[model samples]
Target: MQDNSPAQPAVDLRGVVKRFGTMTAVDHLDLTIRSGEFFTMLGASGCGKTTTLRLIAGFELPTEGQILISGQDVSDIPAYQRPVHTVFQSYALFPHLTILDNVAFPLRVRRLPRAEQRARAMAALEMVQMGRYGDRKPSQLSGGQQQRVALARALVNEPTVLLLDEPLGALDLKLRKEMQLELKDMQRRLGITFVFVTHDQEEALTLSDRIALMQGGRIVQLDTPANLYNAPQSLYAAEFIGETNLIPARMVSADHGSSVVEALGQTYRAEGTTASAGAAVTLALRPERVRREPAGTGPVGELVEIDFIGTDLRLTYRMADGSKVIVRQQNSGGIPPAIGERMPLGFETDSLRIFTS
Candidate 1:
């Protein structure tokens, strides 16, 4: 079989491992990020997402294996020589300099002609829609505006890959959402590779073309947002990517298509993987996919709490097994169930995901 990988990945890590003394910061990891792709490395704290980004940026040297950029081995290259730029969360613009000078600093360091540096800086600021504010100092701008200047500084060089280490972490919730949309738009327009490191699952889902969910210094699952959310391969993926109700079950049978599982003393069919008959498994179900009907129809639960979010109503129920089942219902203008009433909860077979425990 001819290996039909990319002709040259924008960034490739082959069995790369980085250890700080006795502790392994990055386990043996192999990854390939394609050109012009917005790839996010998402995980909890101490999961090695940032370390992997540093390895790609040549900030940290790997103890074993090789790193490649565009098919060339760059394991020995220094950070200054690498065709990559990093945007940290701190928005590290020079406080004493104007926005234009801050963005032009990179070009000036290379000894480019003064005119060219100024033109490039102005163009970069224009790209971020901060051209009119070029004369303002960093202290005069808001947090969002300062971050935009930092983005312009990173873009001025037109690097092959831009590594962002939680660049939106410092912003508030409302501004974070706005910046998420802006960053996505910017990446699509620029068409350059983006390796974003974030521990926030929603941020990864909102911004990435694909997400690499890392755990304990290794990638646990790699897929598009929809795939990772809809058809998770493992229990960890189902729990980590979103809110999931993991119900203990016993597998009755499984094939290439679906599996028959028995849960809460009820028989149900679920999407199958490698689970076989008589094996202990768990069924992953999302809240939005479930519905509540009259009592005596399905799994019975008592309505515990109801939250009136603007667009939807979130209902929490106490299941027969003492587990809480949450249901998200759109505002259809119909009166919801009484707070103390017992109701039956039902969901479709297609939404059930099975994983061996």
Candidate 2:
């Protein structure tokens, strides 16, 4: 499973697997992250994303396969010795110590000179925009500030990679978004590789240059955010990445590059290169892609409910065959249709995604 060549990856995992007794956590996972790139491992809880992050950080050893960091095999290396630092969700700062002391602790452990340690700690704090709050204890600072201190402590060591395990989870939504941008900017400025782990799809989509989506102890999909959203290879990937309406369909006919599916008592052609005729398939249509035409204008559906989601409206409808579908419309002009109203729901063939289940 070794990907041996002249081109070395910043982080590489080959045939990586972790098992707890009969339960397989991470199953034969393989991944490669380029230098100075922001990579995210995203999945639901118990999907082994956190375990994979720990394995890379040397906090846990793989039951099988190897892990390399900057071309060096560090599978057996201890967590402290690895040239990586992790920022945990729970800040893990010392409440008794001031921010400056907390950030300086790592340097102090290395026995650096007091003057040098203070200078480095201050510089790191400045990078996180927490230089002025160095005198305050963790308790005195807000959750976001404490997180900044934790980040400062991790960065003061100048590790080659920074592992963030849901570091922004404790912050409020607005603060969390602000920190996401800040963290991305900081990572770029430092030119250090970042391996972030989170279950939040929006966070991954915003921060990651590439995301490895895990499910059921395996990497189900790995791609750039755009590709993961636009062209999912599987039903699970499509449904997990965004809001998709999975309509039951059967492949009616197929050519070299396209196929027609019969769904909701209508035959619609979809653009997929490979799918067999007579195969049971599911059509993935994004909620935003569905257009509401004039009533009785095209394929008809009854709007059963409307949800006002601040900036947008979510309309739930039922097709002629009693299949439920959701459509997201921007709330620009006025209020949307009330319940029990019928509307024409139409989508282009290009916007449809066909997957064999």
lDDT of 2 by residue, 144-246 (tens): 8889999999899988889999999889999999999999998889988899999999899999988999997798989989988888878888888879998
Residue 245 local lDDT, model 1: 84
> Which regions of candidate 1 are displaced past 4 Å?
1-6
What tens digits encode model 1's per-residue C-alpha lDDT throughout 1-357? 113545677899999999999989899999989878899999999999999999998989999989988778899999998989989789888999999999999999999999999999999999889999989999999989999999999989999999999999999999999999999999999988899999999999999988999998999999999998998888888999988888888999886666788887788888856576889988889888888877446788889999998788888998888878888889898886779888888877798988888
Deviation from native of the Cα of residue 342 in model 1, angstroms: 1.7
**Per-prediction tally of clashes:** 0, 0
Per-candidate local distance difference test: 0.89, 0.88
Q: Would you list the clashing residue pairs of candidate 1?
A: none
Candidate 1 TM-score over all chains jointly: 0.94
lDDT of 2 at 27: 95
